[model samples]
Target: MADIVVRRVDLGYFVRPASETGTEHARVEPTLGYLIEHPIGLVLVDTGMGRHPEVDAHYRPRRIPLTAALRTAGAKLDDIEYVVNCHLHFDHCGGNPELAGRPVFTQRSELSLARTTEHTIPELIDHPGARYEELDGEAEILPGVVIVPTPGHTAGHQSVVVTRRDGTIVVAGQSHDNASLFTGDVLSQRAGVGHHPVWIDRLLAFDPRQVVFAHDNAVWTPGTSQVSAS
Candidate 1:
């Protein structure tokens, strides 16, 4: 099998409240998305930021609009053949409404909540061109590209597992806020001490070459060291 390429898309950033960050003061964090350049087709993960009065006041985001961001990544909005939302948060599914006819792979539970509750921007979820392929569990949407349920950030949160000939890459969208938090979970799992998510073992089973995040720029490698940026 040939190698599959994954590129990072900068959706933009937001100011997270101190309460949410567990810090003395608020912190600015980047919102990231991934572009999987598979031989079969282009798969876009997370669609940047959704806008709303309340959400805007809370996160105070500075978005890069999906088309512009994709352009930076050498892709066009029309080129995306499939969409995978890590979860239905406002920031992740911002561009989904524009994606209209494409097949969007989302967790059944996540979709349910997004529709029934105030989980995300309702317009984004039930727009005119929305077509969702709700998955009950893990599914290999494309060759060597798998969507595994990593529910913790949300009940239906998921991470993309891309297996290439050289190694594997896990696009863990908000599975933990950043790489450091993921490293803590990995260490906890290894020592069998701290509380970690059940799916931690499953992700480790892939022996991922590198792990990326939605809110952090750093990439997590197998060793103690970290890749500052991709």
Candidate 2:
């Protein structure tokens, strides 16, 4: 099998407070997406943010439309054969509507919540010709590339695992806000000190060489215990 190539797509940046309290001040964070060049076809993870009045008022995301973002990654909207959303959050699945008939994989639970709850903008989802392939659990949507449920930030959140000759790379979308938090969770699990999700164990089993984040540009290298661009 050919090696799967994973490229980061820079969607744009947004400013938000580090903590809920205004005392912490605001921090600038980048919204990221991933483009996977697979032998089967091109697969996209997350579609960047969508535009809405309420959404804008809240996040105030400086937008980079999916088309522009994809282009930066040497891909195009038409080139994407399938999409796997980490979750149905507005920032994660905003471009889902533009995908139309393309297969967009998401956990059934996540889809149900997105459709019913006030968590995300309704117009961003259930758009014209929206086709959702809801999964009950982990699924190998593409050969050597699988979607594993890693619920932490959200009940039905998922992450993409791409197996390469070097090692596995996990595209953890908002799994723990940042790679450091994920590292802490992993360390806690190792020590058996506190609660950690079952999915963390599953991810550790893969022995990932590098773990990437959606909002963070840093790559978590477990062996070195350091973050790098990689």
Candidate 3:
């Protein structure tokens, strides 16, 4: 089998309140996507922002076209055979139209919610010929790549886990806002903190070598090993 390589695609940045504290002004956060080059085929995790007046007013997103973003990662729109979204949030699946008819993997519950509720921009979710492979739970898309249901940020949110000879890397799309939050959860589990999410335990079972985030560039490795962004 050929090696699996994961590359980060910078989709552009957006400004939002730095924290839950509503008083403060906005701060910029990077909107990131991932390209997984696998022997089976190429998998894309999250498409960048989509265009909508409401969405534009809310997040104030600065986006790079999906094609250009893919090019930056040494890939192209035509190269992606499959797509997996962490969730159906406007910022996450904004570029779905670009992959029309492609098999986009997402949790079934997420699709249900995206359709009925006002959670995400409706236009982005139901683009023309949007081929979606709705998953109920965890399922392996390829031999070494699996989409795990890691619902916390959203009801049907999912994360991608890529296993390699070296170790495993979890492309945790907004699983937490950043690696630090995920690290805290890991530490909480190690300390036997009360009543953690079942998915957290499931992710811990993978014994991941590194964890990547969508909003932040920092990487969290096993133990206290962390690769901070420069």
Candidate 4:
């Protein structure tokens, strides 16, 4: 048996749709890429991005500081075999075209919604060379790595749970960008923030030793303290 290692890649920021005007406002979003090294093969959590004509022409995905970050993690576009995006938003799945023709796993619902909804990257789900999966339940993406459905950010959003030897680590993706969301916010709850109670409860129930976000450098580990990328 071989061990799989999950590496978080800081892919930098992009503007998000503003909360009020529905206008695109730059928010220094924390883009992330996860690398899973397994004996079976190299599985990449998210492709991050280089550039895209469709996105550039339409949504205007901002500059990426990820080339250095991806190299630092020893990952090249060609090195990736499998891709699992927590969800398919323009910023998160912008890199999907780079890994075209590869096996990309995403929530089944995300794939379907990408068709009519503006919330996703169209190329991601309908790429000519890509193999997409709209998974409904848990599966060991790699040996010790499992993908969990923590839908909230969108109906199909999910988090990746890695059962490591030291302890379990949950890659909470967009379910909650920071530790603050977990504590419960009345305003956000009323406005329908992130994952619902069930999804949030499920991640907490696992009691993962560490929780990491796809965007920023924030980290939450159980029985410990809070940490962020400063």
Best by TM-score: 1
Q: Quote the lDDT for 153 in model 1.
A: 80
Ranking by lDDT: 1, 3, 2, 4
Q: Which candidate comes out best when scored by lDDT? A: 1
Model 4, span 7-51: residue lDDT tens: 887676655446522456545566777777767777777666545
Mark the regions of model 1 whose C-alpha exceeds 4 Å error after superposition.
225-227
Report the lDDT tens digits of candidate 3 across residue range 21-82.
Answer: 25566778899999999998899999988778876877788998999999999998999999
* Candidate 3: clashing pairs of residues: none
Q: Model 1, 108-161: lDDT tens per residue? A: 999998888776899889999899999999999999999999998889999999
Give me the overall lDDT of model 3.
Answer: 0.88
TM-score of each: 0.97, 0.95, 0.95, 0.80
**Which regions of candidate 2 are displaced past 4 Å?**
18-23
User: 90-205, model 2: which lDDT tens digit per residue?
Assistant: 88988888889999999999889888988888887899988989999999998899899998778889999999989899999888677887888788888899877778999888
lDDT of 4: 0.69
Better of 1 and 3 by TM-score: 1
